[model samples]
Target: MQIATLAIIGASPPVRLARMPHIELPRALEDYFAFAETEPTRNGRRFSITLPYMDGERLDRLQWWYHVSPAQEQMYEGTGLVFHRTRAIERFCRHIERWLEITAQRFHGEEPIPRLGQQASSVATPASVELTPVDKVVNA
Candidate 1:
């Protein structure tokens, strides 16, 4: 999973580039990442990804922040998985794999539930391979 530059399709002028790999999460996990947010701060960039948020059930999403400092330092402790913060992106990817494993068990081998926070009534259009810097695809 080497980092690569992604072109910002349909982005406004002064286009931005995200220095990350194409995420491999699928289905509901895919939808969850679709709403992922990236905030540019004076220190660096902060990327946020979260658990399934459908039907407006508030379950302390504030704890899911992902921070990347100016020196390329990263710290992220998944709100649902292990609480220990990690600087390695591969560890975070493992966090996602762990979530998928548990979620599959939770669903009893059925398709993972769509993110409840989106209030999506359907599970269509999972993700975007290309997009603008701030683009968010609504599942509903």
Candidate 2:
């Protein structure tokens, strides 16, 4: 199966792919928001949400996040599962595939992706990250 995309030139997190056949993003997202322990960030062109979930009887353990940046001429936001101790988010994504493995591709597939803005690698980052009140993120 072929994957199609409409990439905006010079955009940080370019427009989301036109859906992949093997990936179940809808079910993945539904599982993401259903019972995610959300940490609200500032709103506007730049915002982020960090969810640390261990277990909820109905939800699985997943360190996930969703973020958007303004400085990169970003017309779209970014999201994915956190790499926690070799744990695959596919457990929540309802599909079998590493999140970044497939996403980190395109013309720049072979290049080393830069680590921008201190993005978290594992389920936990340093204390420099500040957290605020939880709010429903409605991007419009």
Candidate 3:
């Protein structure tokens, strides 16, 4: 006699990759929001996304990997396991989503800055200069 066990896993959560289009960007990150775009593409047999660097500088390309399920795998045989179903693929997608959120906030300047305008005054300057009245003027 032979014994075999089978297990079933629940369906995965709704996940999608958000795409970003090309646009003119600032030299420094401070002016990022001046040009930024978001583009979304559904996961399909050929599931892959590319992030472009707006600046002219040469840099490594950013790529993401996705895994598809057995059923989906069979449907798209030539596409390979890169886009086939797997837990690692789902985890990668989740991480990418979180990264996108943080990147957007950073580029848009949504992140709060500490002590943006608050500064402490020092007493090193002369007392007369510090106490000078704005309405009063001294003859040269």
Full candidate order by TM-score, most accurate first: 1, 3, 2
lDDT of 3 by residue, 1-140 (tens): 22112111332332332332111122322212121213423443334433433222333333454434445655544433433333334454355346545554222213221111112334478656455458877899
**TM-scores for every candidate against the unseen true structure:** 0.31, 0.21, 0.24
lDDT scores for all predictions?
A: 0.37, 0.31, 0.34
**What is model 2's C-alpha RMSD?**
23.3
Judging by lDDT against the true structure, name the best candidate: 1
Question: Could you say which candidate leads in TM-score?
Answer: 1
* lDDT by residue for model 2 (71-112), tens: 332322432122220122224333312443355311111112
What is the lDDT, from 0 to 100, of the residue 30 in candidate 1?
25
Score residue 71 of candidate 1 by CA lDDT: 54
After TM-score superposition, the amount by which residue 68's alpha carbon in candidate 3 deviates from its true location, in angstroms, is: 1.3
Query: Which pairs of residues have clashing backbones in candidate 3?
Result: 19-39, 67-84, 68-83, 68-84, 68-85, 69-85
For model 2, the run of ten residues with the poorest summed lDDT: 107-116
Global local distance difference test of model 2? 0.31
What tens digits encode model 1's per-residue C-alpha lDDT throughout 21-138? 2223233232333224476888865665555433334432212566556555322322211222222233544565555454442211122433322112345887868855856767
